[model samples]
Target: MNVLIVHAHHEPRSFNAAMKSLAADLLRGQGHEVVVSDLYAQGFNPVATANDFATRADAEYLVYALEQRHSHGQGTLAADIQVELDRIKWADLIIFNFPIYWFGMPAIMKGWIDRVFVSGYCYGGKRIYDRGGLKGKKAMLCISLGGQRHMFGPGAVHGELATLLQPIQRGMLAYVGLEVLPPFVAYHVPYISEAERRDYLEQYRQHLLGLHQLPALEFPSLDDFDDALRPRNAL
Candidate 1:
């Protein structure tokens, strides 16, 4: 399996960067082809502009069925943006690694999605959940949280971790046609012991290696979630 790890954190010593590196070694050791997109290292622009598209016509939001085939077919994608499209094209599985900043992705990470997941790159002719550009691929989230897990608990401040990931889980991953899998989240970084951290890291690596044989995750269907659990609200 070709796994693309998109790391959004800026500090090399930060837990976010550490998680990305750990995942890379784990996947590569398993003999899976790995590609790491260190967005900060690459200085990716995390904003969407009007000039990305070659066409401005308003027929409809064309759903992308493949990386190369989107609203414009194969005319030409922006040179800068094309690089990421090429990366997506080469991966069977993608891991989005980042830290939760104000309950959301860093601006650059969101910007990468805005620019790279262009009309043809992500959308298709069908509606959300229908066949789309990322039809055959799988994606996972490797996120780190600064606050304690209690904040995201039932009686705490933030809410559950699952609810916090709705936007990325559904809006980004599933909306693009990739299977939304159970994300691997490491929370309460400030409190964990060295042994606990090592354990989590090891388990994380094991998880990615399993992707080679296991099917892409199908988010478990559940009942009645809060508004925070909706696609737009999940951080």
Candidate 2:
């Protein structure tokens, strides 16, 4: 399988980095082609702007989505965005390796998605959710958290992990048609022992090796919705 790891962390020696490194080695050893996008190291531009397009569809206005569709159709996307898009196109599985910041992804990673998952390419019109542009590909998040597991559930301080991750897991990944896998979260990494950290790495290795057979998170399909996008039964 072709695998792409989009790593977003400033510190090279961080636990998130360790997981990213482990994944690359383990996946390569299993004979899978692996690619790593070290966002911070590469200094990837997280900001979306008019400069993304070489030629403007409408010089008078800067509608990002419209510009993206036009540029992509014209084969004129920015060099950086094109590179990331090409990687996404080539990969069967994409693993996002990052540290959860303020209950969400790092700004750079979010920026990567904003630019790369463009309209008319990743999703647009009716081509979202089950019928999204990346429908057949798989995506999973490998995140490290400072909070303990118990602090993130019902009646807890952080509410539910699933709820907190819905924006990325559902709004981004699934919206683009990628099969969303259950995230591998390392809770309280800063407070954990070295031995526990090593154990997490081994667990991650096992997860990657079984990537093909891992169950994806269930989501509502297009068929389940009515013309107005309401659930059929609700309608």
Candidate 3:
């Protein structure tokens, strides 16, 4: 399988960086082709502006999504965005590698998604959820967090980790029609010992090796919703 790892850590010596490298090396050792998009190393632009498009549908006003559609159609999208889009198209699976910030992804990685997953291609109108442009592809989040695992469950200091990730797992990934795999989280990363970090890397290796055995996270199918996108049972 062709795998794409979109790595978003600023420091090359960071644990997230180690995971990214390990994933690429391990996957390649398994005889699978791997591509790593080291966002910071590549100096990816995180800001979205009218500059994303070479030719705009409406030069007078700036509507980001609309311009995405227009530029994608005209083959006039910015070089960086087009490169990422091509990588997404080439991959059978995409792994998002990053350190969770403010309970979310880094701004650069979010911007990568914002610019690369163009409208009318990734999704538009009824072409969403199970029917999205990337329907056959798979994606998973491989994240590191400074918080302890125990602090993130019911009645704990924070809430469920899954709930906290609903926007990414459900809203962005599932909405774009990628089969959402359960994320591999490296918890309490900052405080963990070097031995513990090694253990985490081994765990991540196992996760990559056993990806096919893992069940995808449940999400709403377009079939379950009516024309208005309300649940069929609701109607």
Report every candidate's CA lDDT: 0.73, 0.94, 0.94
Q: Candidate 1 vs candidate 3: which has greater lDDT?
A: 3
Backbone clashes under 3 angstroms, per model: 12, 0, 0
lDDT, candidate 1, 1-54, per-residue tens: 888998998788877787898888877887889998899999887755545555
Model 3 lDDT vs. the true structure? Answer: 0.94
Question: lDDT tens digits, residues 1-235, model 3?
Answer: 9999999998999999999999999989989999999999999998899999999999999999999999999999999999999999999999999999999989999999888989979998889999998999999999999999899999889899988899999989999999999899999999999999999999999998899999999998989999989888974
Question: How do the predictions measure up, each by TM-score?
Answer: 0.79, 0.97, 0.98
Q: What lDDT does candidate 2 reach at residue 38?
A: 99
Candidates arranged by TM-score, highest first: 3, 2, 1
**Native-referenced Cα lDDT, model 2:** 0.94
What is the Å distance of residue 51 in model 1 from its true position? 3.8
Q: TM-score winner among the candidates?
A: 3
Worst 10 residues of 3 by lDDT: 226-235
Name the better of 1 and 3 by TM-score: 3
Error of 2 at 145 (Å): 0.3
**Which pairs clash in model 2?**
none
